[model samples]
Structures are given as C-alpha cells and as structure tokens.
Target: MMSAVVVAARAWIGTPYLHQASCKGAGADCLGLLRGVWREVVGAEPEAVPAYSPDWSEPARREDLAAAAGRWLSAESAMAPGVVLLFRMREAAVAKHMGILSVAGDAPKFVHAYSGHGVVESPLSLPWERRVVGLFRFPGH
Candidate 1:
C-alpha cells in the first residue's frame, strides 16, 4: 500500500503547478497533488474541498488544512516513506503547504507542487524540516 502511494505520488511529477487544480500531468497545487494521489490510491475523496485563495486560511488564522487532515487522515510520528507532511510556512502562519514523503533516509525527499515548480521531488533539507508542524498517513494505510 505504501509502495502504491509512493508510486502514485511519483506519477504526478512533472505536472504543471496551477492553483486550485488537481489533474495529473496537467496542473496541480500542493494540496491538489495530494488530492490526485488520494484519488489514485485511496479511491474517492472523502469530501468536497471548498475554493480557497492563494493565502488559504492565513488571514483568518485558521488551521484549516491541519484540521481537515485530522478529520480524514491518521496522524503519525514516524517520518517514513509515503507519509503526508504538513508544513507551517511561517512560525505565526497556518500550515498551508503539504507533500507526500518519497524518501525517508539521510537524503530524504518529498513530492509537492510549488508555485514556480511543478510537482517535483525535493530534498528534505533543514529549511523544509524546520517548517514541518505535523505528519500524517493516509487513512487505512
């Protein structure tokens, strides 16, 4: 199952970054990447996602992403492959970025769709590590 998750996530690589989009090899945002993977590996999505702005819920100071993850995903402490990583872009801001773990060893990597970069695998460097506020696993995984 974990391998399937990783495979699904990797398949999204090269997808163009597009806000509020979630089609593989087409366009997707960070959350959209995860949504695409979820559809591929976990059947249908549990619920519909409302439209969101680029700033997300930051202006409202709401942890909307984290709250949804808690409701639909299983929280985990281990930083293993295929885990869902929720990041706090800033100390005082809501966690708006997310990715699926692709590598968990020394040179850890994750797949996410960034503003300038499409869905790409990035090394889990110190800067990225410092922003991780929560880790989770797909439900039933």
Candidate 2:
C-alpha cells in the first residue's frame, strides 16, 4: 500500500498548482492531490466536495478539512508511510494542508502541492512537523 501511494504521488510531480483543483497532468491543490490518490489507490472520493474558496476556513475559525478527513479516514497513531497528513499553518488557523507521508524516518518526507512549487516531496522538518494537526490512513487498506 505504501508503495502504491509513492507510485501514485510521484505521478503528480509536474502538475501545476491550482487552488481547489484536482486533475493529474494538469493542476491540483494539496487536497486535490489526495483526492486523486484516493481514486487511484482506494476508490472514488467518498463524498462530493462542495466548492470552496482558497481561504475556506480562515474566517470561519473551523477545522473543516480535518473534520471531514476524520469522517472519512482512520487516524493513525504512528507516522506510517502512505498515511495522510493534515496541517495547520498557525495555532489559531484551521487545519488546511494535506499530504502523503512518503518517508517516515529520521529524514521524514511527504508529497504535496504548493502554490509556487507545484507538486514536490518535502522533508518533514520541525517546521512541518509542528504544523501537523491530524494523521489518517486510506480506508480499507
């Protein structure tokens, strides 16, 4: 399953960054990338996502994405490779970013889509670790 995730995520490497979009060989946001991966590894998305703005949770002061993830995915206590990660950019902000843990080791790593960088694998450094608010696994795996 972990290998399946790495294979699927690596295929998104060059996709352009697009807010709220999820299309391989084109554009996708962090969540979009996860959605695409779900389609490949699990099945169709569990639910249709409502349209959302880039700042969807900023003003609401809600962890909408985390809540939604919890509803669909099973949380994992250990940082296992291929588990999904939800991050909060700030202590007060809602959890927003999502990624797949590709390497869970001293030099941990994950794959995600960012505005300027598109899709890329990043080190799960202190800065990134501090932002992690939730951890989940693909269902039925």
Candidate 3:
C-alpha cells in the first residue's frame, strides 16, 4: 500500500505546475500533487479544497495547510517513505508547501510540484528538512 502511494506520486513526475489544478499528467502544484495521489491511493479527497493564493493566507498567519492535513490525514512522528510532508517556507510562517516522502533514512527524497520545477523528486536536503513543520500519512498507510 505504501509503495502504491509512492508509485502513484512518481507517475506525476514532470507534470507542469498549475495552481489549484489536480491532474495526473497535465499539471499540479504541491498540494495538487498530494491531492492527485490521494485520489489514486485513497479513493477520494476527504474534503473539497478552496482556491488559495500563493501566499497561502500567510498574511493572516493561518496554518490552513497544516490544519487540513490534521483533519484528513493520519499524523506521523518521523520521516518515512510514503508519508505526507508539510513544510513551512519560513520560520513563523504558515505551513503551505506539501510533498510526499519518496525515500527516507540517511538520504531522503520527496516528490512535489513547485512554481517553476513542476512535479519532481528532490533530495530531502537539510534546507528543505529544516522547513518541515508537519509529517503525516494517508490514513492507514
């Protein structure tokens, strides 16, 4: 089951980044990548996602992304392949970015869609890991 999630996420590699969109091969943002994976692995999303800006409500300091993950996904304690990874772009900022852990341990890597990068797997480098504010798993992962 966990491998299924990783496989599904990897299937989206190279998808262009398109805000608020969630298609497998066309385009998707960080959250969209996760949403697409959710549909493939978990049947359907637990709730509808409203249109959000690139700021992700940071002006209000609302942890909208983290809150939603808490509500729908199973929270996890440590990094592991197939876990949902939520990141806070900056200290004291809203946890806005999302990714799926594709590889864990000494050299971890995660799959995500960024503004310019599209869907790709990146090494979970220190710079990226330091920004992680939340870790979660699709229910029953």
After superposing all C-alphas onto the true structure, candidate 3 shows an RMSD in angstroms of 1.2
What are the lDDT figures for the candidates, one per model? 0.93, 0.89, 0.91
Better of 1 and 3 by lDDT: 1
Point out the higher-scoring one by TM-score: 2 or 3. Answer: 3
RMSD of 2: 1.2
Give the C-alpha miss distance for residue 23 in model 3, angstroms. Answer: 0.5
Candidate 1 per-residue C-alpha lDDT over 7-32 given as tens digits, one digit per residue, 9 for 90 to 100: 99999999999999999988999999
Determine the backbone clash count of candidate 2: 0
List per-candidate RMSD values in Å.
1.1, 1.2, 1.2
Q: Which residue pairs clash in candidate 1?
A: none
Separate clash counts for every candidate = 0, 0, 0
Q: Tens digits of per-residue lDDT for model 2 on 28-108?
A: 999999999999999888899989888877888877898899999998888978889899988888888999899988999
